[model samples]
Target: MAEEKLPTRAEDFAEWYNQLVVRADLADYAPVRGCMVVKPYGWALWENITSWLDGEFKKTGHVNAAFPTLIPMSFFEKEKEHVEGFAPELAVVTHGGGVELEEKLAVRPTSETIIGHMYSKWVKSWRDLPLLIVQWGSVLRWEMRTKLFLRTTEFYWHEGHTAHVSEEEAKEEMYRILDIYERFCFEEAAIPVLKGTKSETERFAGAQITTSIEAMMWDKRALQSGTSHYFGDNFAKAFEIQFLNKDNKLTFAQTTSWAISSRIIGAMIMVHGDDNGLVLPPRLAPIQAVVVPIFKNDAEKEKVMEVADRIFAELKTAGIRIKMDDRDNVSSGFKFNDWEMRGVPVRVEIGPKDVEKGSVALARRDKPGREGKTFVPQAGLDSAVSDLLADIQASLLKRATEYRDANIHNVEDFEELKQVVQDGWAFSYWCESRECETKVKEEAKATTRNIPFNQPDTEGTCVVCGKPSKRKAYFAKAY
Candidate 1:
């Protein structure tokens, strides 16, 4: 089963991703269109992602809670902009238990409206100033086009909603979450990202400010990995979430919402994966290392298995997520290919010869083929494996960062910007006007990804309209 070769990314990037998702046992298409069934392997990967994020949220004083899946349609009307933004995608429920319902319900496209309504009732005094809650679940959007993990009608994520007494506090919360998200991408996922604020036209509906972490994929297209939005008093005013201040005056609460969804898995695959298969970061991979015993006969099998089992136990004791692949039905080569496809960060192979030599063959996933293989003493092998995993993690981040920097070209004019965006990202001065933004989208098929916080001390003219501009923005075709 591992013998079949996938289409090379250079030949067909889209098909390569589509086939790899299923062949790698991550997910499969469901009977329902626009939905996917995440297999156990994929769920384990997601579990690792959520576990890290959940811990970080708790450390920041946020608590987890669940809301009803079905929210009354009327709740959406409370926030006009939000409803308009999501109106086309909402999956409305008009019948329940075989009876036609008078009032319709919208499958939770997002929990903002419902969460706002609940916050209105829960928050009444200055003491309840900051209510930070996160919900972990799936949302239905009725998407017309869907990819395995990137986009789907129903997808998994954790949405965080927080209410603060002041706009300053709410905006701080928004930026704080974006910082955490950027760290997650760098340290855990080994994907370098740019953190910045979204353009007005791209900001979340009803949000005063929207920020995101953008990452460049292998194809040089940008993917919005995570987003954090500051809603000011929009939601609070709409939902009547009023509280008495220190001066005893009533005021609407300032709110923020942020999320990092499963689409991040797609980002990882595109950033670190290769023609061979996935090259997962050690910190986030479900199986950090896999142990395979190589043998030709029963005698060899016994010797190899003894060493392999001991090494697996040692690695597991050292806090490594290890797997023992001692299947007799398949060839050792088959096991290697199988684990390679799964993107286990490290592979430990102990054959009879290695057992006799008191050594094991270590293969690094990030560096494929013989170049990545080495013979290391089995003594203190656990430390050796740990060090290798760390190196691989660092190496992935370095490689991806270099690639991203190399592909971003600064443009001095509209024609140059058009050419740059065809094969890479165009970093140029922008007027931050919808007219200029739309012109680029219409002509070059690129949109403003974000206005990066890191900008030149000196201002320049807009590339599109030649208007005075204060900041530079990334223009790219996005996922």
Candidate 2:
């Protein structure tokens, strides 16, 4: 089948993203509305993402555990703010096994309520204070509108919940997890994200403080990639998670919860992808390099395959994720486009000519066409490919960072903030009041992304109300 051209991002970014998700074979719309089926290729990508994060969590004294999928409906009621925030999205099970249940069970939109209940029962002394656990699973929420990975009804994530005896320890754990999230985005995903505190309205329900790593997509829209929240004995009190302190006094535990979800896959697509397809970062790409043997006939194929197999084996031995595409049915051009669409970082083409010349052609997915093509000797091909992959990784990060920095503007007044948020992010002084925040969202169609930790030494007037403001915040249209 002939491949259909995708709509350019400039032509229609929404359509481009929707089409690319399926065309690239990452995921497909499920039979159920607002659900998606992640294909094998996509699952492989997710595995890499999870493996890295799982290791980091373990390194920080967090252990993986499982929680029940069905939570008691009454559990949510224990925390008023959390229940109020998630009420509309809860999917309750009122019937089971052809019988009407005494009380409804909620398909967990999140495990906070259930997990909190368990913590209350498990903790009885200061020795068991720091209960650090991470759960990896899928969650369901009754979302009205959904995008494949960005805002689906059911999505995959790792939700980490921890408890400590002191507020200092709980807050420290929250910041530590956020730092891990920021590092993962920058190092493994090659996306430059801003780490900051969420405003009161945007903070997670029942959390005393919420922080996130926000990224700028290709269209200059913001994506809240990951979040870490600190609950200062809020859930503890509701769940009655009391423990005997070192001073022999009963005290509520300080708690924190954080996550980096599949929504991050959406951010990667928007941040690094082109009109052609996905541009996955090398460290996270399932297939880092693919070998395409180019030949016209059986004799030529034999010669190219001999060299191609050697290069593939060498690269794989060097700890590179490599694939050998030796299909005889499809044209080499078709194979080229296929891998490009999947965003393999490097493509090594070995034809009869290349075999004779003792060299192979290398094509970079990040830079398509002739500009990215190079011919390197096969004598030390493994080293050459490694260096090229590293270069491409760095180049992608640099290009994306420049794009994000250029589009973020410092606005002096409401008019400038409104105009800037139309196409990019507006960084301006804010009075940090709900009325001012609501006014900007109502008029400009932009919301406060975050109040960044970094700030100016001198205070300024609020962009909206002209009132004295201490710090600035990012305002932008978001996905």
Q: Candidate 1: what lDDT?
A: 0.94
Candidate 1 residue-wise lDDT, 128-240, digit = tens: 97999999999999888999999988999999999999988999999999999999999999999999999998999889899999999999999999999999999999999
- Candidate 1: RMSD to truth: 0.8
Q: For model 1, name the residue pairs that clash.
A: none
lDDT of 2 by residue, 1-479 (tens): 34567789999999999989898899999999999999998889999999999999999999999999999899999898999999899889999999999999999999999999999999999999799999999999999999999999999999999999999999999999999999999999999999999999999988999999999999999999999999999999999999999899999999999999899999999999997788999999999999999999888888888888888999999999999998989999989888888889999999998988999999999998667899989998889989989998999999999999999999979998989999999999999999999999999999999999989898998999999999999999998
lDDT against the true structure, per candidate, is 0.94, 0.94
Which residue runs of candidate 2 sit more than 4 Å off their true CA positions?
1-3
Clashing pairs in 2: none
TM-score of each: 0.99, 0.99
**How many clashes show up in model 2?**
0
